[model samples]
Target: MLNRISLRQMEYFVATAKHGSIATASAQIHISSPSISAAIAHIEAELSVQLFVRHPSKGLGLTAIGTLVLQQCEDVLSQSSRLYEIAAESSAAIQGSLRVGSFQSLTAMIAPEVIFGFSRAFDRVELQMVEGDQEVLMNKLRALEIDLAITYDLHQGDDIEFECLATLPPYVLVGEVHPMAQLRTITLEELAPQPLVLLDLPMSRDYFTSLFAKAGLTPNIVARSSSTEVVRSMVANGIGYALFNIRPKSNLSLDGKRTVRVRLAGENRPMLLGLATYKAMKQSRLTRVFMERCRAYISDQYIPGMSSSAFFDRYVSGS
Candidate 1:
């Protein structure tokens, strides 16, 4: 029988080629640099061809032969992924495991309840949760490291389908002592001059900037933090006010001072929170059931007035 390249060696080679550096690839795959070099050397020896041209300063560069081999390697990897997908579909049982990803703040607030309910209902299905910022979660979803993700409105590509679960209206959180706390509603003009504490995440930063731009006002951002709790704390401490879409269950306070939430007058920056999955993947029976349960839960618990008829008409049409 003719000698064949192992999947492990192919994986290492593909990683090195994609990264363009052995050290970087090793770090990514959690292997040592010497091990990677040795694997590449062994693969080259097996094929009797040099795969990469290593320069003293410019790092690894692929030769023409290397490029051809890399293209074949990619095809092999794709076929391997498809094979796994086929196996997963064949085993189509909801009783196995599911890996879910979501933003940190959202996971902190909503995921616990949902997970708890899901576990009670589907006792055989094991749940694994990964929490991060929007970008991290989305990247993980694209990489196939997660089965599903719940996140804010990305408003971009149509590759990943979105099933919007809820929409939260925008509101300003200010310390009880702040001047705006007394008002029932505040205008964008009234909020423009104040120093703001922003979430500092990409989605939030862009949303707030667009909101201010529409009002012909530029906000004076004095503080920027990725932590939602920290931003709420800053607002509670009277450092600055924050604009957020979610309606917090409990008032966030700093040093015993409660922050008041006031609806923004004539302002509508309702965040569309939803479940997202790749359109290419085969929808498992469990996934479909989970989605249906999610829709039912949202309709019965969150938005009572919003009917399933309306939800399907808007977000789930042709989904």
Candidate 2:
């Protein structure tokens, strides 16, 4: 029975237990639902104990025996992961699985060059990326769900360590036809009266609103969305100007409408783009190499898929 149970079966079980559904686990791990279900069934057959109690609407729940078995499975997976780590340490080649998380807004820009490039450079390593807001990424780091996260230096507690890479100052996005789009720079006072399309992600929302709060003004928020692309599209359609930090290379929205980025004036807080990790967790060779790759790839002068530093310099200099 023990010989029949494989590590892949344990991985499927762990993913299902963590997510509470076979379908959700299949999506996350890129496996088919039937495969996961079969693995779960095989594990149960070998052990002769039911692992999950299925519900029609509520999804699956771990039985008493299942809960006990889940803990052992996690331990086995952890031990198996360490084998790769041990092999990597003995050899000069970097080879292991790395789970990286990125802020939702930064994922599309950085993933191509920074994250995916690392995997290509180190062919032996298996890299997976998860995207979320600041709050979600922080929680994942704490839970050991992701090895590292590329995010802003916001709300980072004592338990997390942040290494700053670049400073992305706030900017405004406006439709090409908007009056303010012609301006060299914009201030919070000038912006307070206009309709605002807010990128309303967790800590991000607070950061943008705080800029108004500190100036003793409230923005006239007309629309809101958690997605950056959605906010860009709304701005391009003349919904309202939105505030942002990571400037993409393209001025056109996904809908093919042109949008303009105007520099935000005055001394406002800038988001520090950087890597985040759990302070208590020991650095594995794979993680350390990946961090090095990130540092080399991202900087103030250049960020992959974002507007060039020349654009930033010209805007700030009012050229």
At residue 134, candidate 1 shows an lDDT of 74
Per-residue lDDT over 269-293 for candidate 2, one digit per residue giving the tens place of the 0 to 100 score: 9999999999999889779877866
What is the clash tally of candidate 1?
Answer: 0
Candidate with maximal TM-score: 2
Off by over 4 Å in 1: 1-92, 299-319
Mind giving the per-residue lDDT tens digits that candidate 1 earns over 29-99? 87556546755776797789999998888899998999999999889878866653554455465467777
TM-score each candidate. 0.63, 0.71
Q: Residue 2 of model 2: what lDDT?
A: 51
- Model 2: how far is 318 from its true place, Å? 5.3
Which residue pairs show backbone clashes in model 1? none
- Model 2, which residues run further than 4 Å from truth? 1-93, 315-318
